[model samples]
Target: MEQLLTVKKGNSRTTKIDVEGVYYRDLNAQLRELSSKGIQNVQLLNVYGQRYIGTNLSQPMEIEISGTPGNDLGFLMNGSKITVYGNAQDGCGNTMDDGNIVIHGHAGDILGMSARGGKIFVRDDVGYRAGIHMKEYQDKKPIIVIGGTTQDFVGEYMGGGILIILGLNLSEEKTYRAKFVGTGMHGGVIYLRGKVEQYQLGKEVGIAELEEKDYRVLHDNVNEFASYFNLEPNKILEHQFIKLFPRWLRPYGRLYTY
Candidate 1:
């Protein structure tokens, strides 16, 4: 039978669990050991707001979380797949290196901050700073997709990586009014599927009509997101997308001296 362990409430708010006797117990050490031993498909029960649920898994293992998970749910995850049935708190997939994190519900702030690789899909709305400080590396690019409206600073200081904000819940009129959407962004792409009037792009970046190449990338990302959340792919492609990129302003040049 599969292992199960209930954490004992202690003086500290954090709960600690130790596993034993079962295939996949809740013990911190054993879980890692089993994963290291090439075990796959671990099931977790009653996981209420637990932090670091499947962090840093060296091997490719599937973890199904039943309840809501706390902040940093998949901190620095290497090569594991985590599916959260409920909502997730702040920093849901902070600094993830590889693999995928699928949240059936909403997510909190800084969802994928500084993530180097991997993909994060949120079926619902998300809080502020969803993809702040995200950078891209050769052969390994990070991508974040939000189904509903996102809060301010959606793609702040993003050196690389692809960020797609689909305003499914809001009207087309007010979808692209996020504050500081691409401030200090130097690389990668930001595709917004709505009528964006504010146009608060950073001095280093410029906005233009998305070309066929850009739409192909956006379509791939959004299609994967739709499949993960069981949405209609064709409908998501109906809207137009605006592509944002760095404007190539020379730093420490005449602009700053003035």
Candidate 2:
């Protein structure tokens, strides 16, 4: 793999890399080197489907990706901010510990699978099984806010964290179309802006009215998401929202005998 790393020093604490056709390994190696050199910010141009672009990066740096990134874009990333100008592929933030990933466009399936901490904001719709198995610890909780609607199984087997579906593009009268939502969900909460029918949800999931705390969470996250995608937060929040949570601590606890 040819290492095409062009480090052009900007005004202060910024480095720009023209990663047109650089291999993933070489690109990551150069990125690590740049981070070690105290480069606080990095801008990658023409970043097309480079898997693991910001994997396991523990630095508190800011990385801006111009084009679409491949799967596992920020896997296990500890502390950093990644802003993607274009859409992203599957598993964007797989098992991320702590950080922020802001996607200006749509994302693929399993958006935040098992992410222990951090936040993922998707401007448009996503594929199936988003927020699958996402969990949280004592103080660390992951959050994912989808600006548009999604496909089936939005929060399958989620253990913890918060998932919000804004449904900004859907009409007011249209019910949420996703099926088998929150299937086997044990923990966490999913908020949907539009109405959902009882048949569309899993047996273990139950609907609830949005509380004051729910509004606060939605306000904070939606505001942040709107700022990233240049949308009006107030208009987005004007619609009514509903919450989905697991009815039983162990949905399948009866299947096995100890």
Residue-by-residue lDDT tens digits, candidate 1, 156-191:
788789988888887735555577777777778888
Q: Global lDDT for candidate 2? A: 0.89
Question: For model 1, what is the alpha-carbon lDDT of residue 59?
Answer: 74
lDDT of each: 0.76, 0.89
**Ten residues in a row with the worst lDDT in model 2?**
1-10
In model 2, which regions exceed 4 Å deviation? 1-12, 172-175
- Top TM-score model: 2
lDDT of 2 by residue, 9-110 (tens): 565455678788888888888778777777768888888888898875546678999998889988888888999999989999999888999999999999
Q: Give the TM-score of candidate 2.
A: 0.94
Backbone clashes in model 1, listed as residue pairs: 19-27, 204-247
